[model samples]
Target: MRIKDAGDMTSKAQETTAAVSRQRHRGQPYVGQPMERLEDAAILTGRGRYGDDLGVKPGTLHAAIVRSPHAHAELGRIDATAALDAPGVHAVLTGADLVAWSRPFVVAVKAPMEQWALAMDRVRYVGEPVAVVVAESRALAEDALDLVRVTYRVLPPVVSIESALDEDAAILHPGVGANVVSDRRFRYGEPEAAFAAAPHRVTLTAHYPRNTCTPIECGVVIAEFLPGDEGYDVTSNFMGPFSLHAVMAMALKVPANRLRHKAPRDSGGSFGVKQAVFPYAVLMCLASRKAGAPVKWVEDRLEHLSAATSATARLSTLEAAVNAEGRILALSYDQIEDCGGYLRAPEPATFYRMHGCLTGAYDIPNLLVRNRVVMTNKTPTGLVRGFGGPQVYFALERLVQRIATQLGLDPLDVYRRNFVAADAFPYRAAAGALLDSGNYQLALTRALEDGGYDELKRRRDAARAEGRLYGIGFAAIVEPSVSNMGYITTAMPAEARKKAGPKNGAIASATVSVDLLGGVVVTIASTPAGQGHMTVCAQVVADVLGVNPADVVVNVEFDTHKDAWSVAAGNYSSRFAGAVAGTVHLAALRVRDKLARIAASQFGCTPAEVEFADGRIARHGAPEFALPFARVASNAPHWSPQQLPAGEEPGLRETVFWSPPNLEAPDENDRINTSAAYGFAFDMCGVEIDRATGRVRIDRYVT
Candidate 1:
């Protein structure tokens, strides 16, 4: 690996299966077709269910959050009597009201920052929810909220990244000095010497702006109360069952198992933005409790932009230590992240939980990473797609390319020298995470060919000579999915994590049912807003069971009952389809064993003698010995009583709550809590930078 940088991402570059391997389907047509989404038909026909689409209950109320207009301010009196009398006004609720009836909901995160579901006394940021109005309709909610008045005394605001980090910066929190929320520093090797001895080094300040996962169907949830009971049920377009359930349990002050979260189809798309949903969902649910009806909270475009979390806006100070060979000797970078209002949004874990992903795909020896989450008045930053990996990769790879150009080596050659070689399967990364397994060279080679990197370089040089400002950039990122949430617990203050809830039990679950009528249904607890869980699962199931993918059906709806899961890192890192496919295939294998036994009993042959042939069972040279599956299934119970395999049971079925041990950690197979397994990393984006304007445009991007 070139310059030893721990946890630094670099690019000069560029599913499923279970019981069935690729070697089994060389000549099959159904093996590789891109799957048509199961819900698209219903969605296109306007028949699919969404959170808001779930008909609101009678006397159901709608809400409009009256957000703080100032960034920081003194607590003041709120006048809502006028709002109470407004058209269709049902109720106007405040943070004080919540504090009086119910204590502030403070979900612990790894960060030291404190949070109340709503501001308890002072305002923190613009658009921070302070008071809420519940009314007859959404329009009425807005109208009634207008009549609610709050008087505040403004304080100096910390709004920029640099200002937030200053020693004398206004403390966002009274006791916590300055605006800094979290500060972490780590080192693996002697980076100073490496940088000094290196024949060449490159230092640059790079900035990655704020962007977020904007799912088409914005986040919307309608929480309904089962009449005459304190129990509440949630229906909406949400991300995963795990984290959402945990967050809700914390907010509602109920047992984790009591909150019933139901999702319908894909949630437009959440990426990392949906992690913020749970806190607010709890707020909406509590609002429903006051109104004595279901309450609907829908995020509009403006609301999403101003209120939803964004990626950590980072100003990275990057320095690379490189030999003439372009071998990385050490890498060190200091980064300042704009965490916005509170680090506790996702909590202490949100800022540094992705420390592993920030390291790209390279084998570096000594690495150093430093980051300080600075609290600003801007919207608090949370996870976005690629999470923090994209930011680190962009800075690292771009810097590496600059060093290669100075050393007169091909960027590709420089990149290859630092890559975790193909022979290095299950390589232990410099930053301490072990890669599951992958052929980096193969993927890079494929991407190079497919991307025309060689040809493009020549064209780029020519284009530059012709005064066309063309620049090509590449970043290879190594992202570990199923990031052990427990890591979040360990990194934070001991009490913070212990209070944050249980160590992540990263497990995912699926329920598969094959009725005698030839319908195959797979129920998954992880909801994929866009990633093709259905296609991937069908592909795996078809191969393992010798059935066409079209014959298999996947039911991905929003409900806590159909599928049970514990870890809720909502679908991002492109893990939804892959994780579900592997797990469901394992379940299918368990069911297939049951099928084989049923077949063995009916055909009067051992389970091993039966082989799946064209979706049916057949013995060598005995075509008449082949028994129809439905026929075999029908005779299993009846024949068992007559003669059969004596004690064997009939009707094939098996259910497994596969909670692999490494369920809370990286998908380290032997580890006790590993859940979703992701094994590869690749990212390339072409950028056009204007030095004069200090602006950059992504001309092309591939992930």
Candidate 2:
């Protein structure tokens, strides 16, 4: 479906405002209040169940992977005779086993690259898994790993973006014919005309390095190949974009329903790093099948750093068309993203995640984007903190600073001049992002006043007079969250996407139910690493049901077979607040409405005339006529079905799936809202540089 026009959006916004007003009048006491996380007590007390803690089944075998030290090489022969005969060795698996038991994972782009858990004919990167040794214990598996021998013929490696782009660079995927996997160009407005007519222009190139967050608990997986058609039961600390569950099932050569994937109660942390653990989960399932027992693997720190995924290293060149007043008229971007070794799924995304907000907080009306995804002999890239924000904004904001210097204006003034007007939202960006609501100018003014901008400038000037290097910097950004699932499709061209059918929306699922004892229960599909999801869920349910937050029980453990989850579920994109929590609130509202109906029947009043407050239900105007919440809730299903409202269901359970209405697939011109909501952030910081030691210290900072 197409997105609504500006007029329709304005009307919808008015309706939403009215609903929020009614909700405020109804009172929500617990929602915005801060409370200690419910998971913290269990975690601090060592009672939390992590991935390694869940593989306690008897006869569970430990697995250690043998990796290739060479970055690029042709696979020759794998002789596992010695390792297979080693003490406690159950089985040894090579590339041959992977070929016989599994299929290659599906790629997101229209590239013919085949990625398997184990290296087959050729290894593309260092630390690529070559073999797996399963044994009674981890030590034995490690010992056996040393005895497995494999022969390789080394080839010249394409390790850098510059090297990969060279005309004669070694082809990593012969089937695709080049190192560049996905390349596309897009134009939103008349950038050529704007550039020719501009009074001033500034261009700059910047590089964002590849990096990864190290979680305290590394990747861990327990896989058991159930006998016959029972399929696979795999548990991991693989916080997802659970969309990969189908990919894992395909690689295992089984139907999606046959794969029972689950996450443990607690993962040390993900920060978007754990999504890459799906390949290993599939690998362990094959190891279990071969060894005739359950197989478990825990990644060590070295393995985690070397083989685990990192954010894409991006090289961006930005050019801006500006007038004399430092107001940007248009922008052009030429970006090359390094997705090391393979074009892993959900990638090339680093180039497009910020596509909608490419202009940052500016009011530029024209834009041109040239995006390229290059493959190199390094660890494959995936998600990390801020996804693509740092890479995009680094170049965009730096160009703004350069523009300020070129115009002989203050950087802050340039920002103020280009800022989208406060009343101009719900704004439509040059590239198809429908910015819902933001007051960029107001936010920037507040930040400058609160950060003591004048005082910072005086301090910098005083330090510079003493032969010291001190400077103050400012930036305004649009933080996009609750990502639409279909935004990734923008990587494909408009025609390709059309052939594949329209994909849109960022759907989240939640369930609210009342227990037999009248306790409130909330279940969410999101897997929390450190975020206080349980506490937030409790607060939402409590406020909806008019009960104490402590009385609500929240369950976050996710099981593919049992939970009411969509492919859009799981914890990334900062979706907890806008998507997941919104769904939880929706589900609670459903239950509240059902309870209100039951209460109104007993109070002999209309459902809208019933009031829910302080663990009791009463007629709105008659406080003397009321019933305890537990009594009314318990009697509905257990003691008195006859007292229930006509046509009302007996149980107090509700499941809800929610997606923002504005999320639409990329249009004919490839314009789309990549996220459900847009939040504004203005940052100002003062830094001092040590001339002799080259150390930089932050003296003041505000966001």
Candidate 3:
């Protein structure tokens, strides 16, 4: 019955999907094809230019950071005299120097907790930077680190959610007065009434441990303080959420325009860990100022693991209101996030990032959320793979399975009963997420058949009969991408947010130009950390211009001073496909339209009658009469400005700044569409537990 209702609801959406499919197949030949990445040849052959590959400058010096060994402690005198007297030592930077030279990094929450690039009078985490040594070489700097005498007075540390919340727990930030920094409660759709009237309720409490992405390359920064008022020039492999660039500039006490920041063409990989490098970038900038030379700091493996950012450790308690038919009607969430020792700039974001999709793929209409951000004696938290989705879904899916058990129904049946109806898209979720499009029921049905669900169940039953522990599982999720910049502002109270001004949209920029020699060049601010932005950009631009993908030149390097970018630019939140590529396509279209107009005028036809294909522009119905694409492109600049169309610029260049129209600021009730697009994924897996070894082995998996 549920499947039939879903099929009935999907008729209109299926028609729309078919129309879109046909439209995509019309002129986008290069886009959907499996073209190899153009960046691989250089990267795979070891010719890639990562952060460290920038090479040493004439007066380059290396830096070694000294970190606190105690989880929580009061700082005492740091005696760097011996380190300064050591061979090849240039200078030593202590917390006092940083306090005098820079300001604490700006954080999102309203709490007055101060976090500087280096620890000030107190250290709250084990790996917090206490001092930095600059020397002639990296090894010398490292050697000098041990020579610097430091004193510390150990303090009680809050290491867990319970400890952090305890009345007697030592406060990490005295100004905040408590370990919990941000807390908010949101109610949507009368969840109280739904839960009270429901026939059954299921609850789950789960913990997601702190974790980090281990990229092949860690943090690296090279900074040079220009003489006098010229300000700072810094290069780093910091794959931004470029909002931090402004934060860094503020901390460095320089105007945004004065700080010139650049990322190398290739980053080893970031996932999301590299955003934390902004703090270190500012640290090295100040180091360069003290050392009176260009300073380079390459984070060693130990430093990277010990001090670098990690995903927030989340504690989620979820309750589901269900009907006798196994349909979930409402949900209540009490979520506590451990953001480590400091409330990093984007700390509370991990809680709100997935707020819109809190209920996951279900069609639950009522939701109540109690979100809290707590601090503990651990590494600070920032973006990581799946940012907040994994933690949210972990508890949500578990609650669904528990609902099935309580109702004595099959888990799969319970899932199908609650999936958002296909025809109801663009469905607005309870928390204000606009689920754009999907056929959830059909997707799950197909996944089950393709994954051989019945066969797996039979195998599992047989193994259980033989006293072996085996199980089959399935999960469905609504994956959001192209994050709206305004969603972070939701962390603030609605009244306070009004004073802060309205924030929304994920802005991206791209530039398409035809060189004087008639070669196409594409420049984008989407910093690709090995995600193949170059390949996709080329494929997109080439399709729009009707040229071979190989002929299109795509540049993915980012420069704050040169590239047209916004605070929302840079990799994270899966923005490349929707925001970055969208801008590239728009810019390419502008260039393509210009060339088509030029060809139209030469052919004595309307611009609408012009067509581009095979590197040539011709009349739509008359392919025989065409001009080479290069000739049409070059005519505007090289030979024929007088013959150009009226009001047409005499250059083949177009720049586009794009953001999806659907993104909007949070409403008065704090409901927001946190992302521009919501994608869906369904996975089924078969696992067997090794009775003796206590390990689980995946026998089969399908997605």
Candidate 4:
């Protein structure tokens, strides 16, 4: 029934899937084919292992944090005596105690601020940790939290972006002097000149509400500090890039190699929520080191929602310059982003991720953007699906609609007029984003057809004539994948960047190996958040090796100590479909190429003469002149080494790294290709409003 309902509304998706099925049936398996998820049985049947499911030694301790009730407050005193006397309680740790043992967390983007495992001298936001209580069980830990007494001197809270940016607002970070942490302006072409020449202009302002990626399971971490030469081992349900291991090590004041970070095979969900779990990873590591035993901390629902990060709230003003025909000539945006409390490692990414996508799907030749990152008494912002794309498009698309309404023109016609043409392959946007490939018009046309746009418009007009409120809106959005890390460098000034040198690009790595039985094994750095990464990986490998998907084993473990990882490796930025898949394909190809060479040597033909067919290595027009993959695979590792081809290693294993070539450092102007591939999504929403209650009901939504 669920599938039927989904298919009823998703006709275009079904058509794409059918096309892929036809391609797979023609013997081009995988890549485009839709394969069944390999993890469903293990996950649904209760066989999956999550972070909280990890068991430690019998002496392991559980920790609970005492958090601040006030949004902004000075730390006066913390009385842990009563908590220490609680039954089963082992130790009580305060922020000052942890401060003496650990250094401040490392910042990815340079902002004048300090972030630590616990709030040291003051609490900037509600639910900020002040003390931690460790006990024998989770229940005892929770019970002891109530006994910990904390005194605070409340201060005025800057709750909103406008208030945070006010002249009289109190500084959140004294070192920064103001609530604004980072501010910058980026412009391309002659925006002022183009605006002057345009005969029509429209301005729009929007306030995007703050929201969060609330996963079913909250943050959980288990940390153990081994004695003597052995270091710390921390396990979590963290879907990560694992580059955070260095940051955590810096906070712990230990060698980066000493902190071994491991993630469970499965996490309930991330949608970018679990990236913020690293600070808790460090906090629990501190708890375990102080307690002299493994320690576990699992965040409850209230704590997760109140304290965990959120997508930054934005206040934006967009101005669009258009010709008489509704073709946009110039665009400008002024935005203020509310980044709560401290600027976490990647908090402000939600503002800069779409630097290239600021113009949406338009061919506007002139553009300007100014972003002010303001600190407020709210949970720090972090990664979420769509990142900053939706925010920019919301303002721009709304402005486009207003222009049509004000000019008495069709909104759809206005979008078609401004769209970047299909022939503009690798089109460079005004903001310097290289749109690798997309057909915006085709996507829009398909959406209109799929959603019955004409019929919907008629119904909406008829409803409006009857004194009922009904409206439809359209948006053309460019979805980018594989973010270039260099985009963040733009947050700093050009003078600062000149001193720091160049920065750019994202990289993904994968390792592929063939066992003695000819079974394929693949390992990548990505941690899956229920995305079926393992299934897709196996299908790609099986396609390349001419074998069944069942014969391919894709290891989805994200262990910094073992996997082939780089700082740029992760599941964020929609990278799996572009960079990660390409990396895996490259690694698998290297192994397949070697296997072909070995088979060619046995067949007494050159490497180019060998071809893959029906799970066997064969020569052209010779069905019987083929060698079983098992026979070829065993020759290298298990058989004699002298039998191998010249300059070929006697193993069927290879590791490869892939990075997009288009990424380049920002020039004199703060502009660069922020991503690799640019895909377009056309969305139309029909909404009806109740005038009395100010309630909005979505009549229909098509994407």
What 10-residue stretch in candidate 1 is worst by lDDT?
6-15
Off by over 4 Å in 4: 1-26, 693-695
* Model 2 lDDT tens row, 1-703: 9977656655555454334323433465777865555666566545578888774689999999999899999999999999999999999988898877899988779888988989998999999999999999999999998899899999999988889999999999999899988888989889999999999889999988888899898999999999989889999888878888988999999999999998887889998999889999999999999999999999999999999998988889999999999989899999999999977777867777788889888889999999989989999888788799888878888899999888899888898899888899899999878888988878888888887888998999999999999998887788889888888999988889989999999889999998767888899999889788987898788787887666678998889999999888889989999889989999999988988888887788888987777778788989887888788777885567787778986778899998899999999898878888888899999999899999999999999
Model 2 TM-score?
0.95
Off by over 4 Å in 2: 1-28
Off by over 4 Å in 3: 1-28
Report each candidate's C-alpha RMSD, comma-separated, in the order given. 9.0, 8.6, 8.7, 5.0
Clashing pairs in 4: none
Tell me the TM-score of model 1.
0.85
Clashing pairs in 2: none
Candidates, ranked, lDDT: 3, 2, 4, 1
> What's the CA error at residue 670 for candidate 3, in Å?
0.8
Better of 1 and 2 by lDDT: 2
Error of 3 at 290 (Å): 1.2
Residue pairs clashing, model 3: none
lDDT string for model 1 (1-703, tens) is: 6762322211110022322232345336444655554445445445556665767667778888998889888769998899998888887778766753344445333334456667776777887888889988899888777788899988889878888767777778775666765666666557778877988777878887777877777778787655554467887666643564765666667666567877767567787687667667777877877787788888788888778788878889988888989988888879888877776444444445555534456777767777676778777666676666667766887887887887888877777888888888666655445566777777778877787776667866887887767777666666556655555543454444445455654555666666655456777776777666766777777776666665678777756655656565356545555555567878778766666766676667788877554566565456777865444544554444353366666544544455435435322221122223436656565666665786877666665
Deviation in Å, model 4, residue 150 alpha carbon:
1.1
